[model samples]
Target: MSGYLADKNICCGCGACENVCPTKAIAMGYDDEGFLYPSLEQTKCVDCRACERVCPVKLDANKGYPDYLKTYAGYSTKKEVMEHCTSGGFATELSQLILQKGGVVFGVRYAKDYIKAEYVCVTQEEDLKALMSSKYVQSEKKDVYQAVKKTLLTNKTVLFIGCPCDVSALKLFLGKEYENLFTCELVCMGVTSYKIAEEYKEYTEKKNKAKLTFINARSKKNGWFVPHLEERFDNGKTKLTTLFGSYYGYGFQVYNRPSCFQCRYCDKNGVADFRVGDFWGIKETDEFWNPNGVSCIFVRTERGLALLKEIEERGFKLFKTDYEKATVNNMSSLHNKAEKYVVLREKFARIYKEEGLVRACKKTESFSVKLKRMLPKGMRAFAKKIYHKLHDKKTR
Candidate 1:
């Protein structure tokens, strides 16, 4: 049988193959694209093929989306949480519940270098802030599967939040379900490489003449509808710019891992106990909708439902909704498919490698966007308004 991890096109870089290798022969190493893939040392090979058995992609075909026990559109009642979180603060609240029970939370956060995102364990409420928002970049998961297993064996409750692939990887590594373990899969569209984030950091610093101290991929300071990237500099300066204006944000769809376009775990097909994402399609006028933010939650297992019940008791507001309504504007909440732009993405990757992110933007950005860039600052906003009006009419 062909090695699943050997095929770069299919590997989600979840590190399960490496983690599951019995001889420690397989290790995760980056490709030219800066995405991780399992590499084997033939000398240490035991030919055990443990990696193959644990591969999520290999096992994905037979497991379709199971019937969900309950679905809801909800938000945390806490005002402070709503202000800081990406969506309805469900993730934060849920993590708090686990921590309150003396359990540990596993989630993503930026490295001290601020160039890479890595999965880390948070045991205290004060440390939860680092893991509160989305990073958008693929996170490094070195040895975390082992750490999670160690914690679970202690009979403590654990909450693991990650992209579908990572959650699957962890579960497959354990090879058995722990009653105390709660897995929440973030609804993912795609994840870009950390290399892009590194380049964008340099680009931003060069443009602003200040080193970045922090970065938030999706900041809701302008409110939920108009999200912006927030950057803080060592010079004590702060900047909030539209996603389109940022190279990393604009190229997010363009620079995702190759496996993302052909993702097998999209929609409700994953192994997570529950799923969470922003409630996109619900209109502001809808009663379930919250102007601050709302999260679409899918509770699959009874354990997941029970957890939600406890959270509700602690002030979470949940309004029951069907899968159809919850995913109308946010199909990615249940389905993950990228728009057709394979050739453009390829071209962008080439330009990005040769000339850097700024040049890639100039070459790959849509003509309408390029035209807007050429317009004066005042007219650009006016043009944006007119375009949105026409777009809203057509979509209606």
Candidate 2:
């Protein structure tokens, strides 16, 4: 209620306040740490508390986790779709279903510059490709909530996909849920800064000697179990490297926004009707185990269940699973905090303010990571195989 919408550690920066402000008094601006915070203009402010009402972080802080109606592991039957997506392609399947019903889908995609990701509206099936993979960076919402409400008011079906905080913010902004609107929140492990995303792009382009044309943070080309970043350059070249090899991915859990470290929505009862993410711990021996990809989904509402049923009827594969096994290797999807390296994270922020992300990550990286990076490619792969073998055993 102070002049700002919420303090840095509490604000998720969903931009609902800026979108809902009647006087256009609220503007989202980046602080020294490069995360967005609401800036209020007292001159144009009506003091109506519309911004306050739309803030999910402030309103839903004390909400308890709800019991899920069901849990499942699945993937799209289409090889082409599953191969190109970050996870099982269930989100793409849902978007396709909504589009077939003459509905619009809302998801995130890189901006024209490709340095930042932002919410985009997709009404055509072909356009869904833009939203295919995961973007670890926090996306800019820029009036997207208003656009979503406007579309829903027309009585058309809409499928909105985003992180749990974003889904909650949109629901709060609408003040009520419309039957025509469906939301699917991605099970998130927090998000990094635009500054880090931008710095990584510059670093990659500088090293590759060409401007970056495209990037997929979680490409499944080499298979889903192993994470990689696929990058394309204007000079007609493409590169695929391990997730840890990428600057943005290397600093992921360590350099997330202050609010993300204390995320309140990382629970079984998320804000969205359903939650979807990689089914990381599915064993090779399981019948539903797919090397191509598999998605872990938790249905929290009847509408979510109905959507799952429809996908199953339309040839998407679904396997009944329990929450415990489904979340085995992906506990960050349900945990509230990432407390691994608080001291190092603070040092990272301080170094980043002066030297930028690439240098900061290099300075703060663990000795093990540095050693792994130094290994020969073949040796590194062998080591990774051994690590995964042990990890799979632990999870099992």
Highest TM-score against the true fold, candidate:
2
The predictions' CA RMSDs to the true structure, in order, are 2.8, 1.9
* Model 1 error, position 205 (Å): 0.7
**Model 1: ten consecutive residues of lowest lDDT:** 372-381
lDDT of 1 by residue, 71-171 (tens): 89999999888888888989999999999999999999999867789999999998999998788889999989988999999998999999988998898
lDDT of 2 at 197: 72
The estimated TM-scores of all candidates read: 0.92, 0.95
Off by over 4 Å in 1: 1-6, 334-339, 368-396
Q: Which portions of model 2 miss their true places by more than 4 Å?
A: 1-4, 375-396
The Cα local distance difference test for each model comes to 0.82, 0.85
Any idea what lDDT model 2 has? Answer: 0.85
Roughly what TM-score does model 1 have, to 2 decimal places? 0.92
In the predicted model 2, the residue pairs found to clash are none
